[model samples]
Target chain A: MKQSLTQIHEMWERFPSVQKELQDVLFIIQDSLKANDKEVEKALLDMFRAGGKMLRPAFVIIIGQFYPGNASKLKHIAASIEMLHTATLVHDDIIDDSPERRHAPSIQSKFGKDIAAYAGDYLFAATFKTLAFHTDDMTVVRQSTKLLENILTGELTQRTNHYDRHMTLADYKEQIAGKTAALFVLSAQLGATNGDAPEEFVNLVTDFAYNVGMAFQILDDILDYQSTTKDLGKPTLQDVREGVYSAPLIIAMQNKPEIQKLLAKKESITNEEAIQLRDMVIASGAVDEATDLASEYTEKALDYLSQLPEGESKDTLVAISEALLERAN
Target chain B: MKQSLTQIHEMWERFPSVQKELQDVLFIIQDSLKANDKEVEKALLDMFRAGGKMLRPAFVIIIGQFYPGNASKLKHIAASIEMLHTATLVHDDIIDDSPERRHAPSIQSKFGKDIAAYAGDYLFAATFKTLAFHTDDMTVVRQSTKLLENILTGELTQRTNHYDRHMTLADYKEQIAGKTAALFVLSAQLGATNGDAPEEFVNLVTDFAYNVGMAFQILDDILDYQSTTKDLGKPTLQDVREGVYSAPLIIAMQNKPEIQKLLAKKESITNEEAIQLRDMVIASGAVDEATDLASEYTEKALDYLSQLPEGESKDTLVAISEALLERAN
Candidate 1:
């Protein structure tokens, strides 16, 4: 987390254009919100103020420079990516059935499910609206829209397979690809699409983004078991509580006979039982194995970055990749 | 309901272009559904075949003619409107918790809530994808996208105001604008845009479509209370069961103290209570009042049609307007 934060800070410090674009994107969304009724406006302001890490937007901006580095368009692209991430988080709060997020009452908890849903819808619509202003190229719109399609497909897969205990590691990977990595790829792809980068550079940067996304998500999964309730901001053990089986738990369940037995019982895995399973996951070397797998993805990301045309943006992207892999530790 | 069906049939019969576009739209949606997973494909097929009257597309075709319809562009416009309508229905099923629709298991019930949600998201994405292919005009896309924004806003408004006994007529109108009339208005506006109709013409046609939509929806509300279970292909008084108080109920609750008491009681309103309230609504002259309002809107639609350059399409549009008002009876 520390390394990831440092890398993000460096990227933010170096990219003045990224800062301006982000500001412009916020302006676009805020302008749209001004049309809402007073109550709706109040609710939207709360959502706006409950700021996130904006890591996804940062990734999008850094990668964007590899393609179209015009400071003007980068903000639109960056803001759009951030909006997508925010939309997912808003929806996730509902699906998780949690009452709070980011030290504030979750949108669903504060405004009710319907308002939260609309707020997400609003942001999603607003993101595209911003993009429409920035470019007339149908190709970009088509690709970005496809990215959203994949994300929803991933969400559906998660919902249908919840708590089944029969979900495979392959299926889990597919879900992550759809939900997490797809956006990263698109962010990188969009970056290149907007600029003079070669087609191969676009693909290479996309690979880097995808690998970093996978590593980031796997680390998130690891933290669900590894971190305490206070350290994570939200509740710990949320995935197990909500019936989501992330990579670490999925791997542990697959390899450990006792873990499989406990999962099959279908009773609430007590805190102690969850702790025992967590220990087994750690002891069986699956966490280490997962961490190693993440490192492989990180190295692949670095490999892609190494081949790209040399620039400060490229270096920042490589640093971001390193930060993601180190977060797993 | 019977009258609405007749109107739908009549509209299709009168317009060959509408027939062609309907076929093309259905085919396009079908082509979008070829998943590698057989089960998903089967579910999507079931959803597609769950026959609708295709009223939204019909509205598009009728309005397009007023603006000098191009048979080629009409296909894309009609298909996009229908796709948007279908997506809304899918999302509405999730919101309403409905188990059945149009005499078949609702999409959410059949595919589970998650898949249904994704299917809606997919359909929505496909709509933009299809639209993006046809044109890069920000005007058309902006109008269509704003339609979705309004629809979501209406859904949120309804959810927050649910079971509120004192909701104003303005509130009810706004909700209907978002929930029901938005797509109809979009259909007309998009048709005009595609047809290259003058801006004034677009305004008139969209206003006509909107009024017709309001009247149509009010009639739908009346049927929920007045129609029998078998006639509706649904259980009687189901709207009341779902806590969706409509205009008829609102009028009755205000005028008849006994009806108000029955609805306000802590217990669930019995079928008997629903019947009594329904009868009181009719007796209070509210049903007739709403019917007259529908007629006024119908006249306004006809007035717009009369001012248009006369053609067979104009006559059909007039017939459609008459049919819409006739539906309230």
Candidate 2:
């Protein structure tokens, strides 16, 4: 769908303030980080300039549009969520040994592991500091923090269970909720809190974000298996190389004895095995099944938007939910 | 300093409640972490049982004890600080490549790199969640978070500068202050804030803690070169092995030509090279100079205590400052 003028204006209005707040919080750490060595800062800044969709921050602002309070404070919260998302991506690259991110060299690839690790830490610290700017309500502080905690737990769970073919869809869902959906949920909740919405509205939006976030991740997982390398902007069968078994792969493993056998080995799968696994997943209709599941979650998210009092912000949220589904296909 | 029955009783009185608050926060994350994986929970609990000096929390409580107000609220603050400290240590082991921590296998060693990484993340989340329990004052949340952000920057600095011989004593001090002393200063400030002390007192105590914390770290670096392996509870030259050039080493390197040459290729320095560097550090009296600097900081810390109102808690702070110097000799 084409962007609405109102949506465009809202997006435009939000970006500069959020960016400024982000810069404000990050300045000290940005300056202090350089004190250790100049190379660290240069490499990190280069990596950070690589483009991101900033989907999480957009959601946060869309939610804030409903409440109409201190726009600057809400913008700080939005920037913080984005910073957190970015930090996780940097660290995830390290964990997955990913070289390319956002069509550019990952911090890990450019600066090596030690510098990448420091970059990730700096971003994480910057996120917390940005969030601290929204110090008016203890509840906001509490929830934002709890969101970070959940994200960490998800990361740990994924780490501990790496490469296990036995992981169920339930396990995948829980893990992704922590790792992927968590910031999404937090973004929506922060928006509601910024709006001074009722606690129930915040809860509903959080639930909506959670489901959509799960569907979003599942779609990504499916695309990882089904999409062309060019389309995905990365290698085919990347998750398997990183020892992460996603939902579609889990489903495909049920019937494909050969793929399962190949996956059980510690070494990288042969290119032939990777192709076979990919083809098997598409042929078995597991990708379709996961896509259908994602749609269900999207529908649930739309229902959440419908429940909110009618407004442009609410309508935009509904539109965004639909757009997110297109990400899967 | 002799043991005081009054101080011990006060600690006992405060410990259970503070622990309970920490447990509540950990329990939230544990529910999700331990839902499917029992190992994560079991390992974390084992670490908790290993028990730390809980110095950060104690500092929080001691400074807090001097002021008048609800003592109960201080529990969450102290617990949160301790949790942050725990999370930092968990990550530090990965960076330091230490095998053991607190007399047990480091989380990185016990659970492998992936889980260890997650465990650190979980603790980080838990720390923030604990902050959320403080529904009364958002300032507490904001200030505490600022402290955390500063500390993480410190860690990033240390990581980025690892094995660089060019780093000056000034650089070392800045890194240590951020990584180690920032939280110590925060602990005192948080304690003072909890007690509802005057801003001047809080500033004084924070300065005291900052100096004491720096002294503590400088002494630690000195002992790493001067003390036996068993006394330090790890290898004698562990920091140099990990590529961290401490203050004493920095000073020693400036004086010794051989040491300068040895340090130039120091990133891949072997065990023998590390010991040789350690000996050079000792022989140059740089260790003694570092110790003297630590003593000066310790004296300043005690001087701050003397300016504070007379109380048993104030006396304890003085004693702790003095004890920090003893760690060097």
Candidate 3:
């Protein structure tokens, strides 16, 4: 849990106001998950302490500042978003059988998959409890609940897409849009709608979040090929072994159709073959091509940010967006 | 899904009205789960079609008849209760890693654990979606969502309590109260509150549900000791293998202290040991003891039902309660 917090924490240090908001979010999550069973309670909190970028909550909190929203309510909503993200992560690790989450052994790996499933289920239920407790608006509850559906549908789609050497770049975009961006859009939308933000502004922030999420996910997919286990705080070639074709691999396969033979290994993918495939994708210059797409999405996100009225919140949003794009880990 | 339906259906034949209500619930569940991804949609439906007793929804529907609530709205809430119950069952199978459910291959066994997890998660989201879509009452949403918490908290507690040779009657009672009774209580409570039922009546129905659920779960555990795999539609003596000591075993252990040596095998318990444990439990007359306790609960449930003003619904509740208690499968 402590592994990447040092780096992610350092990034948050530059924006004390946003940092304070995120700190409150952490507390609300901790308080909300105070379970009757101490072990059940501790399982989720331990995962929370193994922090990530907190980017989703940051989006909710940062966008929350522009005619933003209710003070205490925004934090509750932000905590809800964070908790949903973590629950998906726990389930995702189980699905992928991935050993690490943010540089720590994943819940599924550290505990049994049964414990992992329960912990995730606990978080899923806690999320709704938090939202329903804090917000009377059925729209908030309904939309957030559907947000979970969208996320899982994306996952199911990707599972079908798995090991298909013909998987296209378009498929990747659609998959990630649902898989990753839906939550981001919801986070921004909830913060804006929570208070007095007008419809026009709510629409604008959702567009901004949509773009930011697209770029964020593309960057994440790229890092799988470019970053090390230490840098990513998870296995580097993990996706390849699991037969999940991300952007760089998809682009590389297109440019060099010969790579399909290696991908055709599917379940039989050997460790050495996985390493070879990684080297081949990097060698094919797909990393640079994928980065160009990420940059374009980043530019679009910045364009959305540029339209917001001038303020410290807007400036902080811009700084964070740029830092997120330029991040090494 | 079809394995035990013939038997369960024969029991339901006497109550055509409740059967009709359940049919509508099946349609609502089918309608709610129609998805963007056909496979994702089909996955849950297949599990749903794997017929269940639909007892939870029946509780909601029967209680709704007392106040005679909004027709369509009652169906939706009943659907939500059924979906929640099914979602938990899918997760339970995954946790137990059991080979069968209702005389059919479990979702985890049939679709692989990843798909099973997604299928279960999808149902959880759909359950909330059903509730939110049906009512604007945040109390309904809040309480039902917390009901999920109570159910999951019971599950988490069980994991900690697993394999404990020292498990007591008190521990078993407390565990089943949360695990089994909470949902039943919520089912009855939601239906009563859905209409104009007074606070006093709601208490009566919830108390009835609590006693019924306790008896129902105790009977289920008892069946694990006395019934054949074909009779139960699930593997017999499975809980003993999993170290889930229930009423029969707990009662039998008190009668036969020598059983402790066998239970002390714990994780290393062999197939023969599991069968031997079951035989010993049955031979010790603990099954009879467990049946006596279930009948006592059945009487308490009937007493609560008796307090309700005489009506066709009350009579139906009494009939179903007795039938459920006398059920052999």
Candidate 4:
């Protein structure tokens, strides 16, 4: 059964030790976004305040807690990861022409696409600046840089294959691996390395993160079809509208011949059409299948965690993954 | 007088040693841009072949030649700098809505703005990847990252003040310093430091590059008013049309009340109005003033070159700056 919001909040409350660290990460991000240009600064601040889950940073801190590490350095790496994620979102908003993000006007909608584009670039530069200035480990820095390259390559792949209804399940997996899993792996790897974890532990945590990220994204795509705009804080059926056929849609098309015909039209679907498509996807039980796949990945992640010694850090990591499985936003 | 294209070619011919290295840099760039997505690779390759002056890489190589450094490493750094530059151009073209670049269709024009935006981002990620993977010096990496931050800040400033006809000459100088001179400083500093030049030499070459960069941008802005589209490889009067009052326009508005009144309208200037504005800027002798400033900077750059040990590298540096002073494109 999906956890309720109260349950998710309770799980978060259990991680009070990292709350202060998370706040410090927020401060670092805010400082990085501050600029001499008031307009740019304001735009960035507003976007930051729109409030994300900051799951990547949370993962970093939680994983880092499993070993002895400088809390401050962990916060810096976490902040950098979050900034990079935000940068990608800024550009994604432009490409998707998204009007709202986190229940507020997106950067592109509020400040025009040009500013949105520059804001994304600014955040990217800030991410590197933070890493270069704060992180002492060149190996960590180099690995993070490689992850960014992979992330962008994934984005290019998605862009090139935009609206490719013929895209296979394997194609979807590859895209998400680069787009989503790479950062997750980076977050865990950085946390472990900084925490002075052994090499085997680092590898284990990285594998855990990859599974968790894959599940997380799969759940996210499922939510797009299941949740309301008010609940998700953004529009629904966006993936299909944008021609990005996610797991649910791809799975549904196999069983629902009508879906294939609908997707084959290659034109923008109307509100009625979108509703019909969503209903068909849900009715075809593809959402359940995708959710099951997500659960399987989440189970794999939990299995990896079970290999480590039992501790609060491990418990928090498990709880976070479980909450992600039930997360509505 | 501005030099002819033939003169620029002749100046380039003075540095045949770096030409082979430059080709290697190009190959690295091509390899970096290659992706599983053929369309993206092709677009990037087309942009590369459209041809740039490759002045930044040349600057890096020429400065590196002054000391003993790994040739391949120097080439990597040069390629990284050039890739960073090309990335900026891709974004700039989108922001400017430019149709042509280097006498060919721009990425935005050919592939659309979304793809253009991603291409720019891809290049930036590739740049950092190359630096992290190949360049062992963390200080150089940090400095380059900081330079990118400053460059983006400059871009934000320019965008915020897009058509501010009241922008002071000082403001213009500061903007160009961040937007243009910062990268030039990075190029020279990276080359000198990697070449294992002394601290004093690095500082001196960096300062020289700053002066040269300032002069180059000033001359570039002046040429937007003085040259034709055929000579420029893109539209002429683009700055004024886009409400980007460059050095000549800024200087002209200072002394000519009519020019100020004309510019204060704050709307996109029609071609006829652009021609009139160009004529007014020329008639007001602002072009001459801007030209004099460029020449002063070039002289200062040459003075710095003279202070360095007499060598072929020094001569090539001097030639590059002199060529820039009279360059039409």
Candidate 5:
């Protein structure tokens, strides 16, 4: 566990200055989740402590460094983004019926779905409240809200498309754009705006973040197929079991037509069947194909980063994009 | 059906000028819900067509009349409040597992819980996006977000306290303050601010709206016990069936110890037992007690309106408060 922590820490070493600031943002999140109801406070505190990569906040901090703005205010925006991300995870856990997150019993698992639902909602409200109150700029609030709209829409599309074996690559890409890329864009753009960067710089970061977000989610889908429960902190092929076919599964079906028939079946797939499907997907070279796609996105993100003025922030951004391509869990 | 429509239409007659604007807001909402996915759009459209009294938006229009600012902007804010209310109902139906709403099958019932969850979340994102983009005032956005916090927290408290027969009247009040009163306060306060009303008037309308909201919820609870399913548009004794003891049930339990014992049973109440409990609640005169309490709130709301400057809006506010007390369903 300590080695894993060290690996995670190494990923953020390029932006080491934001480490203490990120801790401050987490404390702000904890304080903001405090409700008149003690149970709500406890639930939120537990979820926060379960821990995450805090990647979204780090992105915000790293991008903000490119320009001149109040680091404290940027921290608040970063906290809001993380809380919003946390809120989505709470709901996603309920929707997925997963019993664990961050290697601990999930909020819904421990508190019941009903409480977990409200906890997710409370976090969302907290996110907006923090954005509206803490940020001096209304543009930041407005832009963040638009990003939230995209994220929820992506979620809606994904839910509607569940069990749809006919879902195409374009459809999957659109879903991930909403579910994943929207927030990345918001983080980078809002950070740039916070730093009082030029519009050209803001747009460049937005493009970079979009590609990074795409790569990040593609890698996540890949990890779901290849990583262990101990490493990914959840069971592998869980998405497929739930009838959600991510990038690799989608690409694999094109090569292995038999895989599509198995997925189309309405009944639950047995453990042996799931393993069979996993082997077929691996054998189809879909893993390699998806990896190449992720790398392509990461390359594009780096290309955008290179267009920005030379600075430590640009270097950190480039490092983060490259590191995302090589991540295993 | 015509009578019910007439009752609803009459309620909106006082604000004839804003009728077109209200329709425009609905169109904006419809446009916002349009996505690449047709299923999501259709579900949202159906839910919107299930229809509501549009009371929150009406309150915003009425309150805005008291000041002089952009009517169009106030309309946008009003739409956002209604969308927020709609979003809560979508989630609440899922939490309660309600099959029907507004005399039609609920979003969850028709589209499944997963889709309904996203639909609710989509509406919420739409609400915030509307508020952030349409209005120029950060204060309005900030205050509205705070109200949303209160609303979701109230919902959390309610969910946590489900089936607890020991739930105090104060606890119930606090829950309603968050769930019901907070939105009303937001409607009035935002409307007043949009119209450029003085801070004094804004605060006055907030107090007025808060009292109106409390009364509104008390009456809603009372109707849940007294009205037929056909009239209420859903089942009655639902609270008791679900172990959610509302106003009359709480008031009756104080007078009859047997009611407490019956409620303490963890098993689901049979149809016969629900009818019997209804009889006991009526026999205990708890209905009258709850009614008197609701009336007291309405009176306070009217008193606040009387303190405001004499205008058409004040008269309309008083009429609405009085009408709310007299509402049978």
Candidate 6:
């Protein structure tokens, strides 16, 4: 968490307004999580304190600046965007049966799924409340809620594809397109449109954001195979055991016979087998292949960023995109 | 489902406008569940068609009639209220590990908790989307969202008390106050105040709604002990097994050593012991004691109702309250 936090601080060191907006975003998030119930409050605050990169909220702030927008309004929206992301992560942990998040016990595992479920549900209430309270624009509210639907739909689709060793790279792309890219595209779109940015600018930034999100997710999938549990802030290769075929695994199994046979057994794949499968995939050089795919998208994102009128906002977008690519976890 | 529908249709037969709003409420709910993803939409729609009493939405429509509220806007708010209730029920089933709802497989049971969790999350999006779309009043949006927080807090509190054999009747009341009555009060308050109803009427109706909700919950608890699975539309006395002490169980255990001893084992209580506990609670006069307590709330609700100016709206609320009291399931 501090790794990306330091990166973000240095990257935004020159932009005082963006920093202020981020502070306000944090304030709004903290305020929203406060509850009349003590356990509810603590459960939610613990998750908040778990120290995510706050990357999505920062993306919202940075993108909002591409065109003129109200800082106060932007901060509240940014907070809502981040809260929605956090809420989804909480539920995702439960679905994946993940015991850890951000290097600590996950809400589901620590608090049990009962409190954790309520925590996620409560954050959702806070998410929309902040969004609706900040903006009078019904379009923004409507589209924001739809973004949530899109994300959950992506997750459900991913769930439906579990345990299929033959799951294609094409299917993986489609899943992340919904789960990851849609939010990024919207964060950028909302920021640009709220400022009344010209149509061309809005379209370009949204596309840029989309490509960036795709690349970000691919790099993340690679980290699962490459990074340690400490670095990743959670167990690695959990997705593989849970039958979620990430890009590297999907590509690796295409030519590897033993890998396919082990995964074919699904959950019956022993822990030792899972470790061997991970090693085999890494040895098969699918990690490098996945990195290449991520680079392609990063290049595409930069291409879109290049077409934008040169300014501080464009410069900041380029910096953030580069940093995401360089992330080890 | 048909039982309450027949009663509502007959009760509102004299007031066509109220019936029209209720019809529009259904339309809005149906529209909100329509999703871009087929699986998400199907899961949500199946839950919708599973047939709840539509009691909460009806409360909104019925209470709105006390003051001349705009039917169009009122229908939208009513729909959102019911959708929120449905959304909570979806999560509740997951938390309780309940297999059935309304005599059919619950969303969580039929679809599994992953889809069920998303379905609940999706409905929340729909809930806020519907609310924000129809009203310009930010207060309404903020308060409606807070209602969600209150409900979740109640649920978390209940979770904290799980397996406590010595749980009190007062504790049960506090839990239900947040879990059940808060929503009821909000429904009535929104209905009254939205139409520019007099404060005196609004206060009376909200109090009336609160008392009515308390009674409604107590009656529900009593039914858990008294009703058959087929009649209750879910397993009877499942709460006892789950360590959720309802009114009859709480009161019965206060004096019955056997009831307390059986509950002390918590989850280790054998299935046969749970059956015996349920039988003992029923054979005890605690069911009648719980019924008398429900009667007290019913009387208090009527006292509040009597203070309201004589009108068709008042009449409808009275009928609904009476019908709720008389329900076996």
* Of candidates 5 and 1, the better by TM-score: 5
Which lDDT value does model 5 have at A105? 86
TM-score for each prediction?
0.89, 0.85, 0.96, 0.94, 0.93, 0.90
Model 1 chain A worst lDDT run, 10 consecutive residues: A1-10
**Of the pair 1 and 4, which is ahead by TM-score?**
4
Give the higher-DockQ candidate: 1 or 6. Answer: 6
Q: Write the per-residue lDDT of candidate 1 for residues B132-244, one digit (tens) a residue.
A: 66655566666777777777767766866777777666677778878888788888787777777887887887787887788778778777766887677666677676667
Q: Candidate 1: lDDT of B286?
A: 73
RMSD in angstroms, all models? 4.7, 5.7, 2.9, 4.8, 3.6, 3.9
Clashing pairs in 1: A21-A75, A64-A191, A67-A192, A67-A195, A68-A194, A68-A195
For model 3, state the Cα shift of residue B312 in Å. Answer: 0.9
Candidate 2: Cα lDDT at B321: 60
State which docking tier applies to candidate 1.
Answer: acceptable
The DockQ of each candidate is: 0.44, 0.41, 0.78, 0.63, 0.62, 0.60
Give per-residue CA lDDT, model 2, range A1-329, as digits (tens): 11111122233343464444334434332443343345656665445444455568777777777667777677777767766777777777776777888777777888766566556766666666556654365666677667776777667667777888888888888888888888888888887778678888788888888888888888878888767777776778888877888888887777565667778774567667778778888898778787887878877877777888787777666765777677554
- Fnat per candidate, as a fraction, reads 0.43, 0.59, 0.86, 0.71, 0.72, 0.72
| Candidate 2: regions farther than 4 A off | A1-48, A196-207, A303-315, A327-329, B1-37, B327-329
Candidate closer to the true structure by lDDT (higher is better), 2 or 3: 3
Q: Model 5, retained fraction of real contacts?
A: 0.72
What TM-score quantifies how close candidate 5 is to the native fold?
0.93
Better of 3 and 5 by lDDT: 3
Model 3, range B33-114, lDDT digits (tens) per residue?
8774686566666666666788998888989988886889889999998888888989889888878887778878877888
Pick out the ten consecutive residues of candidate 6 chain B with the lowest summed lDDT: B1-10
Clash pairs, candidate 5, are none
Off by over 4 Å in 6: A1-21, A134-137, A193-196, A254-259, A309-311, A327-329, B1-23, B134-137, B255-258, B282-284, B309-311, B327-329
Ranking by TM-score: 3, 4, 5, 6, 1, 2
What digit string (tens of lDDT, one per residue) describes model 5 on residues B1-329?
11221223345566666555566667767766765257877767666655677789888877888886897788888888888999889888888889889888888899877787778877888888887888777887888778888888777777777888887788778888888988888888888877667888988888999988999999999887787788987776876776677889889988888998987775578877887889899999999898888888887887888899997777777776777767622
* Deviating ranges (above 4 Å) for candidate 4: A1-11, A327-329, B1-11, B327-329
